[model samples]
Target: MSRLEENILRGLNLIGYNGPLLQKTQLPVAIEGGPKNVEYTQLVNFLTNEIRTLLAIDEEVNAVTSPEDSVAFVMEITSFLKELNCPYTALTDGLVSDRLQNVSDRLLLLDYLITELMGARILQEKKPEKKIELKLQETPEGADMRLILQTLRFPKPPPNISITTLFQKLCPTIPIVLNKAGADIVGEGIFKGFLSEKQWEILGGIQKDLYHEYKIREGNVIDTIGRYHTIFSDRTKGKNELFEKIYHDKRKLLKVEPEIDMADLIAARTDLAIIEKTSNSSVRKNTRSQLQKVIIGQVPDRGGRTSEIAPPSPRNAPMATTVLWWRKRRIYTWGREYGWRSSIQRWL
Candidate 1:
């Protein structure tokens, strides 16, 4: 078996994949040669399923029989990689080509993808799960009684009383006080017409102060009742503020951008540099040849017909020149030729 095939099988085994047996005889003769359509289709389906299983993806895997199918398959993989948040790698037209000819390239890509996924799986397995600590604090000494008094600010309970005893004495009066207050407020509103405007104005001012006091007392009562059940540290103002700050910090951490994958970044930069160099070299070579052609004059063809120089069409433009255009159009093209698409998509 070829080294690539051996690596693929080893990775599959390591990942606990139990699929159809892949053997040397079943694989293509040459690494660069396309395998039979049937074999290629089966292999793609199997590997795709394996990938889905590893990623716990619920998407259905389709069989590849034609170029369109190949394109769809690649698109599905692109989406899967995206969901995984793997470095984006363009893998569309560049892999299959317009004529749908590069079968070997697609096969090689599948091998690489499986390997990357295997590595990702291993890393994921090795990663320790984060545990969030729930820090709890007990109600401190001398603070409990003080908290109970603060919560019952509305009705001043006698000092030095136990919490249970205070509640026992105060509970019966709570409903009675609330009902009497409600009735008095309602009666005042009904009988306000009988009072002079000056008297009404004075009562309004007193009512506002009473309303404010009532709100404070209401809050205190609720807090005291809550303290009876659970002595949460957040009930204390200082600890509550501290916890808020800590929670805000955690939120900020979550909002912070994820770390960039250096390997993918470097690889993408390298590919861009290579493409830029190739594009520049091609332009220079073309320019020099065109100048030479003009200087030397037109040469006659073997059929006695003179060939005329024509302007290069936009369609014939170098892929590098259209890199920005591709990005703008969001036409992701992948394969060995456009490896830079991986990291570039992240920026998009």
Candidate 2:
């Protein structure tokens, strides 16, 4: 027999020697009236035995009840095929060949089945990766929780892991929190009116604080909430002071200098809405000063430089005007006489 036929016969024997006997049943078909030579008989025997061998391998793999047994059968078939040289035709035919061919076929039947099995086994028998399990205990008042449990009886990971593949599998399950500066961050108007009354009160305080600190670098209402708003308005003016108190002392660790990045800070403020929208209303010049006095009177100057500007005493108002008149202050310019009248009459 040729080397190829000899190897085929040996592969057939690996399953059981019953394959050659089964091929004998179909021997008469090869021995037709046309073939009357020794070469024809040899050809018939080779064809019959080879066909039977393939059939037997297919039956053993397909009918095998246990997965482990099926795996073993396939591995042996593939090994034999590989020994005969990997023939791609065997896969297209009724059987499998090439080393690991049967195992590969079984794996292809199910998505990620073979990969999971190998990963699980390697994780158990060897140290491949760091596997940690998180367990949350049950509480009577809380909802029931079900968690998948896996036991990895191993040590540290080997540094040979493929980083490109590792992160692809690990990243999806990790949770992330987006920016909390409300609808402005997302550029949507839907969440604007949803703030509670308490939130508005807190937001008002933040707006005022940001105006004082970063007015040179203006911000919007959204930034007011995110950058300046405080949970406790009375304890301090804004959240910036709180952040400063916590991290300012650790300036070296945080890498923050007294000189601020005015542009970025301003952008954050504008995005958060610390600055109010400008109104187009025109105020009468006389009424405007009076309104300013009323507003300035109501606003409490808490430790700021403006607190030192004491308003004129009730008795000093007349004396102050007399002193200004004695000095002949420019009180009756041509514009002043008509300015108040024109302003009152809604003329300018």
Candidate 3:
């Protein structure tokens, strides 16, 4: 393909457009004052020239010297122009008014962006370039003269890293794995509307930096909980003050009976209400007796302030009733001791 066609294909690739370009579709190209339907190759050819002339881009040199550069230039221009009114555009005059508005609309953002794309080395060809360092080579035969092309290598961008690769860097010897979807979710900071900027930064740092097997400690757990909405620390050290407020609110809620569920109780009568009625004295008496048993049974629970336990039984403590067997020996020993004491007291 010619340089123009090659550059056009490259542009298509860069934009991720898989649609047909070679087909003779209504491309809508150059007309009397502007653009309309034209052949695919013709459309691109016209577009290439119009962009070059309009943007003052030198297609012969630094701007579009190579197909790769041409593609990058074309892609950037197309994307930028798609937002503005074009000179040879087939779009309606109304669209032109809405987008381009006038002639100056063509230069919308081309000024600064053109300069950035011009010398972008990553967009250059991947193949090594040949540069001649010396005109002659020192050979076995005194000096051998030859045209030289030495391969000059430039560093390429690193390949995309996956979560597995990141995990390997973070924990080399461990068998732990991270949930890719969860990692992405947490990294995005959109889920639960909770994760903080610092939390996302810390997570991204772990992906890039080598880290040992780590756990969330008190100090850092607070940071995690503060930054992340999901990973909660019940005992956060106040980094997540909002959650701490929530924790307190939840504790307060536990003490409050649900008002919504109790709404139906407006029509309900209490046992005390029924017991106080004069004609329902039998039920009242039974209820009183039952209430006494319930109160007695609940004594071990200390009125529900603490957990329940079996009430202590007197029958369970056999040693409390067993006595007097050792009293006879105690009395005999006391008598013998007192016999000596009586004689000693008389001398005193």
The segments of candidate 2 whose C-alpha lies over 4 angstroms from its true place after superposition are 1-6, 20-235, 240-348
Runs in model 3 with CA error above 4 Å?
18-20, 23-34, 39-348
lDDT of 1 by residue, 1-348 (tens): 557677766765776656454555555542333332545555556666666766677664465565446556555655555655655344433443332245445556557667766766787789789899998665654465456546545466666878788768766765576585685442322231255779767766766665566667766765564454223433354576675666566544432222333223322322234435545876677656543553476776656334555667887678757777866555355532468776656755
For each candidate, the alpha-carbon lDDT, in order, equals 0.55, 0.40, 0.39
Q: Model 1 segments beyond 4 Å from truth? A: 29-61, 65-68, 78-90, 93-100, 130-348
All candidates: TM-score: 0.29, 0.16, 0.16
**Candidate 2 local lDDT, 219-257, one digit each (tens):** 343344345423433434556676666644544343212
Model 1: residue 295 alpha-carbon error in angstroms? 99
lDDT of 3 by residue, 1-348 (tens): 334334444554443434445332311121111112123223344344444554455542123333334334444444444443345342223333243222233222222232323333233445367786877656732221111101111133235855466445544322223252354332322223344789767655654332222222333654544465534334445566786677666554442222322112222323324335554877566656653553355545337543566676977566544555465456556666878645444533
Best by lDDT: 1
lDDT of 1 at 83: 58
